[model samples]
Target: MKTSECMLCPRQCGVDRSVKFGFCGESEEIRIARAAPHMWEEPPISGTKGSGTVFFSGCNLRCIYCQNHEIAVSHLGYAVTADKLLRIFFDLQAQGVHNINLVTAGHFAHQLIPILRQAKADGLRIPILWNSSGYESADTIRMLEGLIDIYLPDFKYINPKTAKEYSNAPDYPETAKASLAEMVRQVGAPQFDSQTGLMTRGVQVRHLVLPGHAQESRQILWYLFQTYGNGIGYSIMNQYTPMPQMKDHPLLSRKVTAQEYENVIRYAKQIGIENAYTQEGEAACESFIPKFSGQPQ
Candidate 1:
């Protein structure tokens, strides 16, 4: 949990973050690009109102097809103190959102642990979701044993070559597997509100099917279904929006085709993945991406 020689992520780029930047492209200080109620997540998480989402700047993975490359890569955000983040949590809770969703926040686990502890102590009662890239260190995830109520981590890749090519993380497959195991350990079972149907505690794994990676997506789905089964929830996403950065890349320059997405969905059905969520309509469009205005909406 030391930010001085930051090892909070699997990268282990031991640079003094206070004085230098790490592979995550962030300093010791926590930066937030956006804080608002998001209605685009899974139904249980977003509900009728929305999920109070805090988009943290900086990421452990460098995904070339990232839709939020503005904040994740460019780091165009203002710094916030622990007290400010604590207040943001309570303020979002006051907005009547179903839960507090922390997006891509595994890199800031050091600062978030204490801030989350204080938020709960100050009567922040909404379910807090740790929305991460799934390229996490198991030890770091263990530090958040009692604090987080829900986990929404992405299982981006199962092949090391694909992971390295897409996100520059070769160890992503093993790292994500271990991290997910730890998460399931922390949140034992999926719990839901009787009336609202909002998720109170559990883990939901998401996989975004890439343009030409339908086979790999099937592999990931098979792995998750085989390992966790109906013990956890699944989100087979088709919203792989091609960003401006991927214009030159042949494969990533285009959106996922309808047939490709349907094939993945068919495989999920074939594998008996009942407790899952799927996207409908034109999901591979930039319109679905949220705006990072650096101010809460």
Candidate 2:
């Protein structure tokens, strides 16, 4: 869990983070791009009040088609201490948010445990959600056992070859599998607040249906249904908007076709994954992406 020779993620880029930055382009400092309430998440997570979201800068597996490329590729956030982070949690709690959502905190999971504990001690209510890229170490997830109430992780790719070609992580599938198991073990079945319709505990697998890869998406749906059954939620995303930088790239140069999205959805029905969320028309747009430059208002 030491970032001095950072190994929190599967990358294990031992870079003595006290002196140098790791593969996540961050040192010991906690740099966050945005800290505010986000309503763009799934129904239960966003609810009516919206989830108190904090977007962290830098990422372990920055795919070629990353929607949050600005924050994922650069340091565009304010550096805050553990104490300050706890204060942010308290501030958001006062705003009457549905939950405290920690976006992409794996790189800083080493420092969050104590802060979360202290915040809860200081009367921080509401569920604690960990929104992740799913390329996490099981040990890292284990460290956050009771502290994290909900898990929102992406099951990006089922094939190692696709993972390697897209995100440069050949070990993504296996690594994510282990991480998911740990998360499920921590919170057994998916449980939601009956009155509020907010998720209290459970792991939700978010699989973005990539263009020209609907079959792979189908495969991932089948795997999730077979493995977790209806105990977990699956969000089939159609929000793969092609960024301007990818205008000349090989496969990421176009948006995910409507046919491709439908194909994936058809397969989901075949697998009986009724406990899933699917997108509708015109979801692959840049309007959904939040600005990651400074303090979000």
TM-score of each: 0.97, 0.97
Cα error of candidate 2 at position 31, Å: 0.9
Ten contiguous residues minimizing lDDT sum, candidate 2 = 288-297
Give candidate 2's whole-model lDDT.
0.88
lDDT of 2 by residue, 231-251 (tens): 888899999889987899877
The 0-to-1 C-alpha lDDT of every candidate, in the order given, reads: 0.90, 0.88
- Scored by lDDT, model 1 comes in at 0.90
Candidate 1 runs further than 4 Å off: 295-297
**What would the TM-score be for candidate 2 when compared with the true structure?**
0.97
